[model samples]
Target chain A: MKKSWSHESKEYKIYVVLCLILGLAIAAAGLYALQKLLVPKYMRGVVEGSMIAEYYESEVPHEVLFLGDCEVYENISTVALYRDYGISSYIRGSAQQLTWQSYYLLEDTLRYETPEVVVFNVLALKYGEPQSESYNRMTLDGMRWSRSKWDAINASMTEGEHMADYLFPLLRYHSRWDELRSTDFEYAFSRDRVTVNGYYMRCDISPEGEFPAPMPLADYTLPETSMDYLTRMVELCRENDIELILIKAPTLYPYWYEEWDAQVRAFAQEYNVPYINYINLRDNIGLDMSVDTYDAGLHLNLTGAEKFADYIGQYLVNHYELTDFRDVADVARAWEDDILFYDELRDAQNAELAEYGELRSWGANAIEN
Target chain B: MNKKILSVMMASVMALSIAACASEDEDTAPVVLSGGQTAESAEGSGAQEAGETAAASADAYVFTYNGIEIRMNAPANGIIEALGDGYTYFEAPSCAYEGMDKVYTYNSIVVRSYTMDGEDYIAAVELKDDTVATAEGIRIGSTEDEVRAAYGEDGQPGTAGIEYTLGDSFISFIFENGKVVAITYTAIVG
Candidate 1:
């Protein structure tokens, strides 16, 4: 009778252990599924928001890293760098990404692999403090969990954002359930690449138009906080033995003021960094504002981006001792797949333009009802 | 034995609670579209269908001089065609203004258009040279005193320009070299 009672107790203990493990497994899986569903799948529309996150999925190492807001991502063609110069690069960018955000992104990139040169667009330096929460989310939401990401969140959070909300995005995106579409479920596990090595392409051409004169600012000096980040970015690159290049993308408007340009030039000179204001070099680079720009003179379409990339690629080859991977069989084989993807995206965008008289499958309008 | 059953029941309840909250919160939150329309109301009346129909017939829509009769959100192409084909169309970058899409240039006159819910609307018209004048005879070269005499003494003066408010529209005259370099008429939309 005593032996039988002991056996029964042991059986009960084993049953409880099995049940606990099963419950915990189910809970963890459910949480992960919920998190995936709540996050924005940039596959369909507003794909610029997805550019930063897409960098992590790349298995190939980059020789160059371009970091900035829309100006860098929309204006540089990484594929062109690889195709024309055999220089692999990635642009870690998002919409209205601030200067501090760029610093943390560099820190994040160093963790994976250090690039020889880091090109930063200086336009974001105009903003000293955090901008809108939506823009912040577009830049930050795609980052994988790391101390760099945590610091980015802390530095970039606006008035109403909470760090806890970023840690568990379910709290911030709980309301997105009402806006869920079929794409949300389809891309819950994985997403189609939205950019070609961090280069967003637009094939359509819109001639540059008259822009409003920039309103006079009370203070023309660059914001101290933004300048501080610029300093930190320079320091971080120096520590990593990486060369940092400061550039102002030749975007015609949001008017890069002369005062602003002078400040950036002085900063670059002080840091002994290579600073190139593409706005001044547009004529030399052979960029035609009439055809090269997609939206008025604000951003370069694919043609202009390619031209800019070609010009910069030559500079990289001439100045830096980057390897020409064209002769290397393995590198060429890897790039072959990327080139195919780039051509496919270009053809798709052109087809969309022909069918709709405008691009409907890309940009912010790509999200379906 | 009871403890085991209780633990299983508690875990199940927690999971159910989270799922329930997701759906319930979604139901209570409002869905707003890009064009500032409620999703439910926009779908019911079909904003796109109505916009297409309106765009097709925008030739009949006209803004009388000194009046706000311009259709607030009709396609710019149809309206430009209605006015005349001599106008040059310039596609403005989407980032040019908060919501501007394109601009049509006619002689010295420029018309700025906005897009909402994939449909275009006339937002503002400006005269940058001596080729056009307002209904009140205020031309681009009109002086500040002349503007006040033509429109009214009830005007606001700022550092860069001066503005005179009409019913649902306002006229702004930009000052450069101490003279009016441009005059713009803008429609107010909610």
Candidate 2:
């Protein structure tokens, strides 16, 4: 008689246990592989999604950490800071990164390293509540699992977002299976570095054009939520003995209202934090918007970012005691790698421009979405 | 035997999940058709001259000025041309990338256009003064009751005003002392 499988048999029991373990391992591996395949590669156009994760790969310490929106990420060049002033800095910036998100990111950064100075751009203060989900994902998705990431997700989720979606991004991005491309498979295990210490480079030039008149607003007051986060950021930095410098980058599209600037200035005064509105200091910074801006007057091109970095680096070195990383051998070697990456990115962008008259690989024209 | 069945079932479930995604992949596949071209550039090149007109015919929140139908989310060039050059223009660059957010102010009304992808679409039309009114006859000076009578009570009321959402756009009215102080037709951009 063919003996039926018996739980009483030790051999049979061992086989069953092994089978169960194998099944679980397979299930877990399958899900992980699926996740790797479905998630956006962010290689082509919208590379901002990859910026947050790149911070973990930094082997060198940074003395300056920048936080905020594209105004910080796209407007300032970190490599230029390193090259010119030997000021080691990193930009923990994302597209339209909100104030609370910045606060949470600052918290996350302190977990690993505390920079001497934290520079925060003030333009994101205009947004009071949670904005778009896509923008939120671009800001929050690359963050590694931590208490700060958890809080950031809780604070940043839009109406339709759920905790589970962020927890298993596979669940949120499962529908992206159809959009999978060659790059998705190529980068499934690892992704190419998108930013140079968080600097998004654009070499193409579009002169500043005539902008529309600023629309009158119903309310001029900055949101209490943003103000509270700013206060929390100040307190957090104060606790860590870190200097928080507030700045408004010199971009002339979103119309930095006098009322808004006045409020930020008042907050800075009350908190005794230094505030710089670069719009007022455009000439002093030697910014020529006509040739400097790549997208009309929205953001600075590579040349403009280098100029802004030089100006900010001067202020940083003058005001705060930042490390001259060039003198340190190990740190200098790491930064030299970064400088090479920056140069390569600039060359690639410039090459494309020379061929296509515009950046076909990196700019608005290259956006996959 | 039961243990083997359970393990197989667990493995099968995960396998099914993977298979299901593969099966639905074709339906959701993204098709990249062409390169970027601004609406103005397309119009100038005569490749998409009728595209905005086609979009205009779709159901939209419209603010008609001098019989020229200005539809929300439709290209702004046609309406601007029909409305003539009598209006003042102001433009601001978008936050993310290329393109501009444009505002055209005529004597009585203001038309705002936003950029998506690389094209300019009418984002909002504001009746700045009492001189202009919606096609439904609701003007800046219309009473709240008059607006309610025309738009129905389905409007989402807030501290600022009441907004009636229609498809992808909304008609908002700012009320002061039970009277409509401002009126706007706006597209909802996520």
The model with the greatest TM-score is: 2
User: Candidate 2 on A1-369: residue-level lDDT in tens?
Assistant: 876756688888787777767776777787889888987766776677788889989988989999999999999999999999999999999878999999999999999999999999999998889976667777788898899999999998877677877887676777775667788899999999989999888898989887655544434679999999999999999999999999999987778999899999999999999999999989999999889988877899999999999999999999988889999999999999999989998989888989989888885676664
* Model 2 bad stretches (over 4 Å): A1-5, B1-12, B15-63, B68-108, B114-122, B126-190
**What is candidate 1's lDDT per residue for A225-244, written digit by digit as tens?**
99999999999999999999
lDDT of 2 at A215: 49
DockQ of each: 0.07, 0.17
**lDDT (0-100) at residue A201 of candidate 1?**
87
Per-candidate TM-scores read 0.72, 0.81
Q: Tell me the tens digit of each residue's lDDT in model 2 across B1-190.
A: 6755685858766675765455332332111211243544335322243345446555667777886777787766666767778988776544343346678989888899876555667888888888888878998788999999998988887655788877678888888898888787888765
lDDT of each: 0.74, 0.81
- State which candidate has the highest DockQ: 2
**Which whole-number lDDT from 0 to 100 does residue A10 have in model 1?**
78
User: Candidate 1 chain B: minimum summed lDDT over ten consecutive residues — where?
Assistant: B29-38
Predicted complex 1: CAPRI docking category? incorrect
